[model samples]
Target chain A: MSAADDEIAPLPSGLEEARSAFVALCGGVGGAKLASGLQHHLQDRLSLIVNVGDDFDHLGLRICPDIDTVLYTLSSLNDQFRGWGRARETWNFMHALGQFGGDTWFQLGDLDLALHVVRTHRLGSGETLSAITADIAASLSIPARIIPATDDRLRTKVVTPGQTLDFQRYFVEQQCRPRVEALRFEGADRATVSTGAESSFADDTLAGIVICPSNPYLSVDPILAIPRLRQLLRDRSVPAVAVSPIIGGKAIKGPTTKIMQELGVACTAASIAKHYEGLVDGLIIDEADAEEAEGTSLPTLVTKTLMVDPRSRNELASRTLEFIQRLGGARRIGPQ
Target chain B: MSAADDEIAPLPSGLEEARSAFVALCGGVGGAKLASGLQHHLQDRLSLIVNVGDDFDHLGLRICPDIDTVLYTLSSLNDQFRGWGRARETWNFMHALGQFGGDTWFQLGDLDLALHVVRTHRLGSGETLSAITADIAASLSIPARIIPATDDRLRTKVVTPGQTLDFQRYFVEQQCRPRVEALRFEGADRATVSTGAESSFADDTLAGIVICPSNPYLSVDPILAIPRLRQLLRDRSVPAVAVSPIIGGKAIKGPTTKIMQELGVACTAASIAKHYEGLVDGLIIDEADAEEAEGTSLPTLVTKTLMVDPRSRNELASRTLEFIQRLGGARRIGPQ
Candidate 1:
């Protein structure tokens, strides 16, 4: 109803039998919520293309925050109250690290340190991040496929007022205090799109692709910055939709709106739609931003997109899938 | 009473005030026990030259078992029951690592892992092992210095039936299951002795050096393997003595007896004394091996060398210092 376009097509019938598999593009926390929700409804049929842009080495341990968040979310091991890291986590490692004068701003939990140690060891032994992630997911008994955007180095560097900082340093260490001048995805130009991620789009029974409610520039854009991934999404034939991270001129979490404002862009769902302009067939906005959605020409789904709990997450995921099926079954919807 | 040499020189005047500093060559556990005893009496006057032969990277963690044991023992944080790692330790990290199918054979406690993480990170940042160890020791407020034998990769390799296994693999992972074979310190010929370790011997107030009751072939010899260290000990004017690791024709701990037997050497204090024939001026024997002292040409001290308690350790340490003083201050004791 928020869409300005009057010629919007209705959803196709038989969604249960026709659609069997789909991919979800996700960041940590917020996106992981939707990804977890999708996994809840789609079960093993879901593939999460997790952002590895925030990956960095801390104290010689390879930390992939976004991938871990998604994995923890899907496996139901993530702390719902804390909104990060493993549930029932201990801080003995962090306490000890602090005693040794080590940098403690990142806050690596004791239980979570095991994954990093294993990952750093395996990566040092020449195992691909994709392979290790897949193996870890399987070990956790997570049926859904969790894939990184790339096994290669494609770090997201945030250029602030005076200096550029690594994604984790900017976000976790500095607490995003620095005013962002710009964002750059290092190594993204030459980095290869993960095979699993690319093939997810080529699946014959692919229902659609859902860009989870993650920061457009910070999380999702880095994955899209890879030329191969960018080109594939541009030329793909499947219906793709994005759930807006911004709600009521403010981000639900993190510095999404602050970054958006710093970048000289309006912090609104209309801007989010414009940010994904040609890539997505539809945009899902929160009920709070329904009135502002009329400014965009893209088809829109107005609902309570702030996925506060499992029920809300599932409801949002179901609605997004229904919207994707409505545009066209396993086919891209042309721009109005 | 144990020494046959009646010409053994008496202590120099101002013995307590003049002789303020000394060094102790130590390995883990038993050596640390004696080192702790020495520390109890000497306070800040002791410097522990710990063996680095057992140090190895497990799961990318630069694990220095001997140095850690000495540090933990001295700091009173060592788990007396387990004879390793920090007290009040948790195994959440190890359990998680096991869940991920990682190498969990080498136990890394949650609290202990912080040390490895910090060490590995600093090492990766190009900080020398000695500098890091010093920093860690300072942070822990340990009065006595705990110096590794070398900063270089001087690993102890065990030559088994047809293959060479790294020290930790031969010891911890394999639990010393491999049949006795020759032991070699890889990189020993090229490795430079740690500066602090070398300087500890050169102290002007250097009362003497005590070779703690560690394995002769497996532990003590590795420190002696470095040509420079061996030469330093040989040319030193200070009195040097070794407390026997073997008592009652058997090693008190570890695989000393097994390894000695495999090397075709008798597991006796006499064989142990012969092992350090020229390096040590005197040998301290346990009451059980008091009769074996007659077989050695060197001056000997017979006492309860099994430092089972703090009181016993303090007594043994006081006796060793008194014996060193009696050998004539600032002059090497010639062979009897």
Candidate 2:
């Protein structure tokens, strides 16, 4: 059990009564899937600290893609077919924008444009991203607390062999084709963690922390790059675990594996576990990567991690929570 | 015939070659209708100086309603049924905006939003509204030069019995329900006419100027409120005529007659003509207001000024041009 639980009373035996609340750190899409599952499993007890490194200003609108994904996913408005944006989304905005000779590389769907417009207005009016996100999530009737890692500016830049490009320029405009040499989170060095996120992390009732299956180099690291935020995660008093974004030496979506390969890192669950070395107590891997777990010294849980449907998402969430409970009860153990 | 035509060569006997180029100052909707007719009739010879007083920063978007109307109407993309915005527009943005608890009072259509997005971005990047408007009109393949009255800020404000309100607040939000007492064009005193509009006005090839059938106080006055703009119109060498916004003691649309009555003026074509006594060389009135014309001192053109369709719009435009040509040849004349 967590140190706080041990101090309070005997640890609850059942999964549902393990702890009162937890925090989940994640990026867009893949992370949103697990965030959705976590919300279903924990309801209002889950607080999502979404990566804002992917946030960018386009056409004067501040677009927070990761926050929107988590919001759409948790609110059940996410398009399962396209795996992004709201369901029944229209592309007429981008279509018309194209007619006006606007940049259509990063498509802004009609319904999706609304969020960006409102968010931009709010941000321009002195509302912090954290407050705006909370307001939006609440308006969407999402029970979970969706918080940005920080409210201050912290944009990700992908450093390629030839030049440095903004996250979206590299990801969307160039289709992630550039050979990545390194990555930088501008403004993160002096940035402070969002008040809501800081409070949520320090909450005495926090059960565990889940570093969702998001890209470590791009998504997760930006949040980690913030000094205080990284410090909090590194010195967590509860059992913290991570779900591997990589499975069978390839990502389920996006360019995670390619980035890892470009960084000259081994494409294995053990390698991912090593990357998270001291921060996470254990790593959850797909059954496809179960063989690779033998080489890791950290505790690991092997399961069907490809959450293609709601059922799979729920099942994986349950398995992840149960694993956290086991690790909480018996400190960090050797690899299974 | 226009004096410029006499200088170059004998004026052609037909409506097509009566004058080379003319300037049209207008607002939204009603003004746009006649502007459309003028564009079809004059082709590249028509330069529209649309009123920017109605322009406002709404939710971080620089919305120029009159400019958009002129653009959409000229391109035949205007929604004839709805009387505003682009044809076949979608409300997915507003729908999602409402879901996000954003202000849905000002409805932004999916297709119409493209202009605002691009305009806002360009404005943020220090591009003048005039330059951006020209670029947009050119991209839309509109032959006529569409220009804002001035690039500097000039917002309309309405004074009610209770308090003052911004133009959009009085016009759109209040539905023009407030009892108007006075009106002001904020920042107009310091505003300068846009370069293209100024050049078009001073062009030696100028035929005449058509002050469109838009609300005199709300639309036309804002353009006139600018000191230099008004001075230029007053001292113009060519015929300058205005089509009466009021017909049969009532405005064809909006609150022109209501505002007139509220401001202690008679709701008649005579009152409208008198309003521009020292400004316009002549006035065009609907045949229904023939009696009201007898009271005006300026040269008056009696015609079916109610342009309910394209046929009527084009017919009125042809008649207006013919009248301007006659006045251009003979100079200002007594009422007939």
Candidate 3:
């Protein structure tokens, strides 16, 4: 761990629930923030099953946006102000790339590009995405095990009215301005869960799952789209709780709310719960949405779901673990 | 063209010989500097036949070091202080790569890496090296046509007593410490000369060839090792002259002198002339090696060959062209 990570104050230190391994299904920025919170509390006991649906081949390099964000965020190397990529990054590579008429829309920071190059080289040599991510996480001193949902090629193709755009084309290059008609996980059926996540699912010490505050359709859906991974989630006896990405009828960052609105879904905590109705035992909403708690059919935990800072993220994580223990109804070892 | 290229005062402006198309067989650094001078004078009329033997696939990117050096040099983007790569280059990529436990021996500057990424991507998409190089040169606004000797894979392997090391592994990683027992071009036989070079050789306006002051055995020999390119050189009626890399019994840069000693050959202008033999008509020797003029069988031009600055490079190129004109023995258009 870095000197910076050592200085984080180690939140939720007294929470014994952290000893039992928990997995968070994550997307990019918003989800990565909560994943960082879980990582801090659980340390090595946490596993982040990051979405690979947004991963794409650009400039012959394998670029996994969500995985990289989680790696950077947990390692405390992320740009907090920008809410993405490594801090103190340079644009010299992009500037030079523009001089050669290369695609500049993705905005790959100089420090961020090194990760892409390493991942591309390793992937080209037949190394799995999960293995590479694990090594990179270790290199960045990220205590949590960051595994891809699947090692196989599973792309999320966004179906707009006129075109079927690649995930990055819709998300990054197009700035998500295109109204989403639908979304499809291209190779989801063939994709299988990584051994790391599979073993975590098939383990005795496994605790409840926490679906982080990421977009439901874009992030969580892709993982669940994989039949093998979905089967594992379905067969688990432990409770699976989800923190709502929606706060006060809006997403904190990104086009989550915009996408939801375009897809004809209401921008409310009840709608967020409805999206994950079958998959999750309960939904954790923000204090602003506490009024809507009785509106959902499933059980609910209303808290400050907006992780404005590290402290708020830790509080939400600790509360969510307590809620999951309540939902499971048996796996509790009380405070001595 | 950049404002920097325009700021460079044009040289040999009124010389009618500069109108005639001349091709320079070049390698890296030293040759690139002279090629820059030639480009300054000849512009669109100059063609650089760059050696591709030193090109290697490093970390999944096709890195053509010599070609990049020549392009940077001719485009006035080369670092004057470092004598290689782009000026104002950043090492952020290398720094970040080290964090991932990546290979750090071959230092890839952030600005320089953009070219490799572009080239590698294009190559993966089935684009030829010559075509991509031409596109990149055009993007850099370089008027001189920079042509790779071959589009095929041709690597220079250092055959030391202990092991056969890759050119970069020997040159950069080991810092050229190992004694050079021998050297071999891995795929020279199958490689064909680029169309840009073949067309230049076939052109009626072709004046002569200026073999730049790169290492004779390692650089120029690789081009000559290709049977077709050698036959074209042998068949050319125009005078082929060489600028001797050796001066005052020492090489200006690289392992030229050490390699000569290891191969049991003397480092002298006469020895350089002997190495070329029938491949070149005359040799351009530095004034420092004026005493060795009598020792060579071929006709020699004794001049200041140390290209300390841009002006020196221009002066040497101007002198070499003048010598080639004199060696050709007939065609002259002057005092227009």
- The TM-score, computed over Cα atoms with residue i paired to residue i, of candidate 1 is 0.93
lDDT string, candidate 1, A59-127, tens digits: 888999999999898888888899999999999988888888888988998889989999999999999
DockQ (model 1, Cα): 0.70
Report how closely model 3 matches the true complex, as a DockQ value: 0.84
In candidate 1, the residue pairs with backbone N, CA or C atoms under 3 Å apart (3 or more residues apart, or in different chains) clash, namely A11-A326
Q: For every candidate, what share of the true interface contacts is present?
A: 0.81, 0.92, 0.87
What TM-scores do the predictions have?
Answer: 0.93, 0.94, 0.95
List of chain B TM-scores, one per candidate: 0.93, 0.94, 0.94
Per-residue C-alpha lDDT of model 1 across residues B233-285, encoded as one tens digit per residue: 89877889999997788887788888888899988888988889888889999
Runs with alpha carbons beyond 4 Å of true place in candidate 3 = A1-18, A330-336, B1-18, B330-336
Docking verdict class for candidate 3: high
Each candidate: RMSD: 5.9, 5.6, 3.5
lDDT of every predicted structure (CA atoms): 0.86, 0.88, 0.87
Candidate 1 chain B lDDT trough over 10 residues, lowest sum: B1-10
lDDT of 3 at A196: 84
Candidate 2: C-alpha RMSD to true structure equals: 5.6
lDDT of 3 at B226: 78
lDDT of 2 by residue, B1-336 (tens): 123222322223654654478999999999998887787678889999999999998888999999999999988889988999999999999999999999887879999999999999999999999999999998899999999999999999999997999999898899999999999999999999999889998887788999999999999999999998899898898889999987787999899888988999999888888888788888999888998777898889998888777767776777778788888877646343
Q: Give the clashing pairs for model 3.
A: none
